[model samples]
Target: MIIPDAESIAQARSIVLAALSEAHAKHAGRGFDPYEFGADVSPLVNAYAALTILEKEEPSELAEESSPED
Candidate 1:
């Protein structure tokens, strides 16, 4: 898979936060309290952090050699 750049990463974060916010709003309207469930969202947070780390690391030589010239 092609690793995303900084801007792409930011856009993804925005999208994820927006989706989460929307879901929260929907549930709140139905009297859902997140604190009551004590649900941990760490998995999703950790996955996103891992993606950032992958983006920061140098691209694989194979990826570099295979990508078309700009």
Candidate 2:
């Protein structure tokens, strides 16, 4: 029952994407093959993933579609 402060849709999307990307890198690096043209002893496919990872973990509430007006 983790009640994360209700974030906007965009914010939630960012979190999921970041987690998936990390899992891929750790898995991908394990699968690296030096014989291949694009390979490495400690491979990395973060290719702009660092750039893509949202600077803000939570986006502004303004991203919300609609909310009950007080």
Candidate 3:
């Protein structure tokens, strides 16, 4: 039963995205193909997916919906 706080989840999302971006940059240098690092980077894909679910379920900001008069 691991419950993460909102702040922690947000921080994790940011860190994961940053790490993925850095990893991609490293893979692109010296003619290195991304496929060669698929195994190592695949977990990031899952992280993105998990974050998406969390974001949708627990959005940081919610817009108020206006109701039309009948």
Candidate 4:
């Protein structure tokens, strides 16, 4: 799992929204099914939710310090 910074989180949200929009368009044209969109996005949504919670709980210093550079 990647620990996303604020920028990465924003990018991920954008990507997810874009994917959902594309899925909707494809379904409208009968190229893909609506149900498949939910299946495809469920994991990304779940992971994002988990990451949001984790970010809130994480200590700021833990992110600021680098273990390898220690």
Candidate 5:
């Protein structure tokens, strides 16, 4: 299994956040596409939720990697 580097993880989060923001805009526009929301957005929402839970439960462990090493 391959581990993700910091840049990789950050890029992933950025992508997910951008997608979710677009979804939110779609939601605000009163246009909901079930197929697109399900096929495209569901997994990203789940992933972001999971990451949030992890951050809450293991803040230190997650933050450790972001710290500079000497």
Candidate 6:
């Protein structure tokens, strides 16, 4: 499995938020596309949710990677 780090998860959240904002802007004073918004934001939401669950279960696993000593 390709596990994402906290930075990556944050970036994903930013991307989803941006996309949702854009969608809202485009649909302002009009009907929005639920399908499009759902498609754009679903992955980020799912990823974040999954990360949250994982964090609760194994918080320490998210610590910084350790380097080998010389």
Largest TM-score belongs to which candidate? 3
Better of 1 and 2 by lDDT: 1
lDDT scores of the candidates, listed in order:
0.65, 0.46, 0.72, 0.66, 0.70, 0.62
How high is each candidate's TM-score?
0.53, 0.35, 0.64, 0.52, 0.52, 0.49
Residues 1-66, model 6: lDDT tens digits:
345666766676677667667766776547678887677667757865765664454434544233
Q: Say which candidate scores most in lDDT.
A: 3
- Kindly state the number of residue pairs that clash in model 3: 0
Clashing pairs in 6: none
Per-residue error at 51 for model 4, in Å? Answer: 5.3
Model 6 misplaced stretches (Cα beyond 4 Å) = 29-70
Least accurate stretch of 10 residues (summed lDDT) in model 3? 58-67
Question: Which is the better candidate, 1 or 3, if ranked by TM-score?
Answer: 3
Q: Whose TM-score is higher: candidate 2's or candidate 6's?
A: 6
lDDT of 6: 0.62
Give the Cα-based TM-score of candidate 5 against the true structure: 0.52
**Residue lDDT tens for model 3, 1-70:** 3445677888998999898888888887757775776866789979988877766763323221233347
RMSD of each: 6.2, 9.7, 8.4, 4.7, 7.5, 6.5
**Candidate 1, pairs of clashing residues:** none
Off by over 4 Å in 5: 31-41, 49-70
Which lDDT tens digits does candidate 2 get at residues 1-70? 2223434434665665676577667657788444552443222335334333434334444344234466
TM-score of 1: 0.53
| Candidate 2 residue pairs that clash | none
On the 0 to 100 scale, the lDDT of residue 58 in model 6 is 41
